[model samples]
Target: MAHKKLQRFQEIKTFPNVFEMPENMAQRWTKHFNNQHPLVLELACGKGEYTVGLARLYPENNYIGVDIKGNRIWRGALTALNEDLHNVAFLRTPIEQIQQYFFPNSVDAIWITFPDPQLRLSKAKKRLTHPRFLRLYQQILQPNGVVYLKTDSPNLYQFTKTVINLFGLELLQDYDNLYAATNLLPEHTIKTHYEQLDIAQSNRIHFLAFKLNQTLPIEKDVELKKLIEIHGTD
Candidate 1:
């Protein structure tokens, strides 16, 4: 089924090296956007379900779906093109190097959906909500930018909650089972492909939202050298 999906959307807009985006391209992007629009980024954005949906729902805001898989992002890119959506874009890249592409305080919000938990203790730094990645997110996000996360892993949810609390960040919402929540906005409650599958299987879906406060203390960087010594370089 995943293979068929990839085959269907093969000929769509895709970047070969999203992380190494040129400085000139950045200038061009700034010129194209004129710095007047709000930018939302969806990290590890698979097929860009949220990105396309947001483009349709909030035409005033611009959305970018960042992911490493070209085939996965093709569907979202094609959707934007087919719909003539001027507010959406797609970038194919590893999420870890996101800071290389976006300017500081350029992003207004972020959506993270169904990311791998990287469950090994030694791989903690590779997690999207880890201190290192959070630092990168802080560099790109606006002062009051919000982050939304949806995942099926209870461990990831607990780890993220702990990290947020430890850093004194505010948690807007934390639900172990999102479908059970009656208060979510209709727009905010839409599920992604993976999310819908999980729901159909009677699996609990976790979700959380939090604001980025510039005043909060950033956590100390994890020692990558030590991590490497313990886990070896992958």
Candidate 2:
């Protein structure tokens, strides 16, 4: 497994769809896709399933899968190239630095599928939906640009709700059990390997779609910390 991982890491460097911290990446995006289509990002896109899936569903839009693991992205990059998914691309970078690669108001939407819940209170800041990450998302996301979260973790679902409420973000949609809900869209149909494993063992998938506020206040972060300390049981 180690040898295979090393080989994939070396191989992805040559892939036309993969970019690893390339300088002035924001300027190159338009040239890469050769169109002025809307940009959508799938953060923590393990295997780039959602990224590729969304691109396939919406040919009018461009999708980029952002993850730090090269070996994991190799499968999606290869699949995109093999299938000629011109709208699909992969970026190798930590989610924390996501804003650095995209210019202000450049991103149209974001999807975070099956990300780590960061159940421990001590790790709350690391959660993708945390205020810290939201601030980063706000930097690049267009005004009222939607952010979607799909997870099997009840804790994460509730935690994100708290952040949205506390931060005054617009909650466009919320579903505690996505499969049990009606009028599901095409994007909801895509599932990753981790989702199949049911790692959370919660059986139900939670989904939240929201828009960030114009500004995520710094003072509210202090309040958020206090609330988590008092009420956070996970």
Candidate 3:
């Protein structure tokens, strides 16, 4: 592994603000904070910009940044420690294993910020909005919990909208062009590293928020598959 990555692995081990597959994970988490504050998870939280940002915005809620990369997680973990953000924590784990940490209905909401669109049709199951992941999210999420997505990829934006429609989910908010509107919400203004480096240079940022329907059945969309097959995606 890279030197920085090795160092981060060693460093985060001691971070009071970070947790890595801890014992009694769920019980300890709620007790550590000594409150029943709503827990919000940021999946694929690269460097935890949205995690820390949201923690700062909503002090009443606890924030956990979940990502597999120790090196990337170190930045946000240390930031929370340095700033004394007691409610902010980073979880170094693969997004696929989220259910291992939190109990069902324990999480209040989820945020997926600038995640890989998994643009290719072959990678559809890997997309964060894919039915497989959504089902996993639903398992742990509170009833009617909302999933918020912020991305610069129009394909991912539309793909999520399609999933919502296909699954009969409740669409709470949909901003195709986030910056184009006047009165941008504070949470909407937070930018992730990927947003600056790859997506925002030319493309407009998009925000999608929807609630998971517990009874929604899973089915592949042939029309969506054809769309991905015909046109390339961002």
Q: Report lDDT per candidate.
A: 0.74, 0.93, 0.85
| Candidate 2: tens digits of C-alpha lDDT, residues 135-188 | 999999999799999999998998898898887889999999999988899999
- Please, what are the lDDT tens digits per residue for candidate 3 over residues 1-234? 688789889999988878887766877787777788999999999899999999999999999999988889999888888888889988877888888888989999999999988876788878998778998899899997899999888888888887787667899988988999897789989988899986545468989999997465644556556655665442
Clashing pairs in 1: none
Index of the highest-TM-score prediction: 2
Tens-place lDDT per residue, model 1, 2-25, is 877666445553432122234545
Q: Cα deviation of 228 in candidate 2 (Å)?
A: 2.4
TM-score of each: 0.81, 0.98, 0.92
* Model 3 weakest lDDT span, ten residues long: 225-234
Position 95, candidate 3: lDDT: 83
Model 1 residue runs over 4 Å out of place are 1-10, 13-23, 33-35, 199-202, 214-234
Cα error, candidate 1, residue 172 (Å)? 1.5
